[model samples]
Target chain A: MKNLLFFIFIHVSLFAHGVATGDQGYIQQINGINFVPFMYLGAKHMVTGYDHILFLVGVIFFLYRLRDIGIYVTLFAIGHSSTLIFGVFADIHINAYIIDAIIGLSVVYKALDNLGAYQQWFGMQPNTKITTLIFGLFHGFGLATKIIEFDMDPNGLLTNLIAFNVGVEIGQLLALSAILILISYWRKQPSFITYSYSTNIVLMILGFMLTGNQLIGYFNS
Target chain B: MFNAQQPTEKDLPTSAQLLKSTIIAILVTIILLVMVILPAEYGTDPTGVGKLLGLKEMGDIKMSLLEESQNELSQENNTSSIDSDSLDKAMVNNTINNDVVEITIEPGKAIEIKLEIKSGSLVQYEWKTIKGGLNYNLHGDGYKGSQKFISYKKGRMVQSDSGELQAEFDGYHGWFWRNREEFSVTVILQTSGDYIQIKQML
Candidate 1:
């Protein structure tokens, strides 16, 4: 419960800062040491992003082995990285809300996988590796959309991008580590097995919530 | 199908293996992602505006000799990408300022059409279940918030349930359907001359 409270606090605070008005033209002065700050910002965004964490949780939920986790995550990473770097670097203009809604649904997808919804409901197992990879591409594209919102300069593009990428990696590691710790401890409790089912249910609810919010936003205003 | 025998423990991953594999998976995924994204970032502009505006092939002994003169003007400004035709259009009609449209099309081919609105001047190309009638139809994007001339009825505005295609604007950009196929797009603006120039690339 304490952990849950802490998680909620982190989520609210992060969003308060991360959710900026959708004007892409706001130019802030980036210091010449471009790599560090941007990278830090990228990393911080990943670490503190609740939306990202929900998806990550779903990605790892069913995997009992590291190899499975690796394959799926790698697929996601590939999809996102390709789109993110390429999208922003290439300056592809995308709608922020629509992409985000898809991103929200990606979380639901993983949660559904965890719950064996596909197998039970449809009587088939989806190619988890491929789906993750495809969804990862969408996720990466969303990130790219956010980054492109910044009027990035041509100078030191590689270095700065590298820094930001590294920051993301660090943030992912941190978030994953914390999740591992919590889940590991939870797994020891009597309710762990029962909670596993609930975990996915909650995840799915959150995904629906996210998607619903984005869509309503799309139509409204 | 009620009760099948469960798999044995020998089939499941050992705890040690699980831990090792998870760590390695995270590392491998991150490395591969970065590797894929980095190169595409450093390369050409993804927005492809320069293509839409015909900036790259500006200075040729083509059509009106506007290309050569525009190239000289663009060179003075250190801009390697700005269409000569687009400049002329801008001088004539500037509906939206500070917007440049780049289009990719086959050489020496540009579509010309004049649009006259009986009601309001917004025009859109949309899809219909009955082909021509407005029973169940998709609209927006190239339609530019234009009306379909439905008698005394406000143009229908409904959110999509099937996720058919997201709301789109601009003929060359946004979600569109020639026959119900979705294409992600990047639209640049020209705003004059020949109403709009559309270049579709998958």
Candidate 2:
């Protein structure tokens, strides 16, 4: 339990929307379409992105069917890919801190939905699929703003963005596979039912932390 | 079952209870954000807990490094967008001259020499230490009241360095040398370029 808390703490503290410095330098220096490198960077960003992972975990927390998971994941991917490509191509530069804060709120929303808080509080269940897709859009904007900060070379930008999107999908698949396996294993235990409530509460807290951190950054910046 | 069993109505908490849980979550988030995240990441310690835990120092260093990088980015933008006509005019107005100056730094002492150069101007410089190696930083201060600082390069225990420096802004560009050895070190600095003036800063 202590180790788990420590892991979450580390993720929360280091949750700034930035590419690695070396990767950023490479992005700025390269002029033409560099398909493989950009794809690798995209995968790296997704695999290491705690905010995105947290949201994904929330979205799939109660999902027990593989088909449902596939549908939801596809919706998320489509939503994010549309915004990511369009946002970067049109140079729609939203403030990163603001977009990140919204992404954080998406995590909070999902965690609350998993806890059944909306049903109890508002007496109705919000459409989970729609919310997931919308939040995915915000997440893509967060990524787009970070990329814009690098001032990437315009040559072959579309092809590079497409490569990056494909890499993001690949990374999502890898991460989701691990998560699904772990959750499936855990579901066979009696403690899974007992501990589910507390787990969502912890997720909610992390969501709030991400939101608060980004807001502080927004104000300070 | 297609999914995890949904909680029955009887098992669900009351609306008030749900609100209470939310308030608790928010409270916990606020406490952690103020006590841990602010101090460890931003160096902002309001309740004094961060300093006690030795996290404020990390925050301070991160903030300074962020400032340094932002300054460098702005300097790069400034240099890249400099008007060629203005650069040419500045070069024509400033006569090219070679100057060699030698300064001695006693043990644990430091000295700085600055050249007044406009944005996009270029200068070639060579500096070598006569005795033991010294720590050196090549940096610049922005012109006027702009609170901009750019660090071009930094090195420790360097005996000699030769390079061409292009001004990123109209400012005082220079090298600061510090002798950490027990004995004094003399630095011979030779510079030739399009600059308005060169002087040792007191």
Candidate 3:
């Protein structure tokens, strides 16, 4: 638990800075069908994307079946992939900070849904799949905005984008499996119940933090 | 089937516990921002702890690089907006003497033609690439051994230019044209000015 807290703190601190200059230089300098490198970069981005991970964690917290997991994850992937391509190709100009804040709110929404807060307070359950897909669109737009800021060359852009999306899927799968394995083991412990509540609460708090940070950045910038 | 794994009310945290956890998370976030994010992103360190951790330099570099790149973009826009037509009207009224120099510059070759003029002398000059655009610089070099040089204008792929120049100091003043095209091209230069002499410096 202590190690996890340490990891979370470090991750949050590092993640708040956004994309590094080295990665940005790589993006700006490259052109044509740089499939492998762009794909690698895309995968690397998804893996390090704390916002995406937090949302994913909230999403699968209650799922026990592989089919259910597949359905939800695939929906998210579809939504994310479509918007990512469209946002970049259509030259969508939404501010990244705003999109990121919305992505943060998606995390908060999911955590609250996990805690059954909405169902309890309002005696209503929002459509989880649609909500997930919607947030996935926001997440995709967030990715698109960051890449657009990289000022990548237009040559072979479509091919590079497709390759990047593939990389994102690969990264997402790798991260999802790791979380699943860890959670499966934790579920067997007697402290799982106590820990789960605390964990979701923490997740919700992290979500709020992300939202607050991005909102502050938006106003300042 | 999807609803089977829904959590019971017992799995949820009490409102008080939730509020406490939220506060703790916010506190952690604030601490991290003060010590790390602000220093590393904006170069603003309120706690002074970021400097000790060497994160402040990272932030400083990021902020400076962003500002540098933005400045570069603006400079590019400014250069692109420099058109030959901006000085054409001004050059018409100041013409006093007309001298035309025509030269055929070979591919990948350059030539420097200058006019020896006195300080404060006014000159109206125009040049055009008859075949292809070339890179040109309008500059002044002081008298022999003085080592003084001043740039009046510089441009790339310019086809034509007309301007009136006021000599800042007594020196050889004029254009250096480099033919960047694959083939030879002729440059026609017309000048009307108060210069005492015209000669090819190089």
Steric overlap count per candidate: 18, 0, 2
Clashing pairs in 3: B40-B59, B97-B192
Candidate 1 structure quality by residue, lDDT tens digits, B1-202? 2111223456454567557757776786565334322222221223543233222122111211233223323342452133344435534663422223333222222221122111223333322222211111222222222311121111111122122222232222222211111222222222222233333221
Question: In candidate 2, which residue ranges exceed 4 Å CA deviation?
Answer: A1-21, B1-202
What range of 10 consecutive residues in model 1 chain A has the weakest lDDT sum?
A: A19-28
lDDT of 2 by residue, B1-202 (tens): 1124653445434556555655665676588579766875677999998777655644654564355445444543465443344345556678786899999998755677988788888999999988788867788876533645677886667899999999998877888776657799999999999897786753
Per-residue alpha-carbon lDDT of model 1 for A95-121, expressed as tens digits? 777888998898888887877788788
List TM-scores for all candidates, in order: 0.48, 0.56, 0.53
Q: Against the true chain A, what TM-score does chain A of candidate 2 give?
A: 0.89
B179: Cα error in model 1, Å: 55
lDDT (C-alpha) at residue A137 in model 1: 80
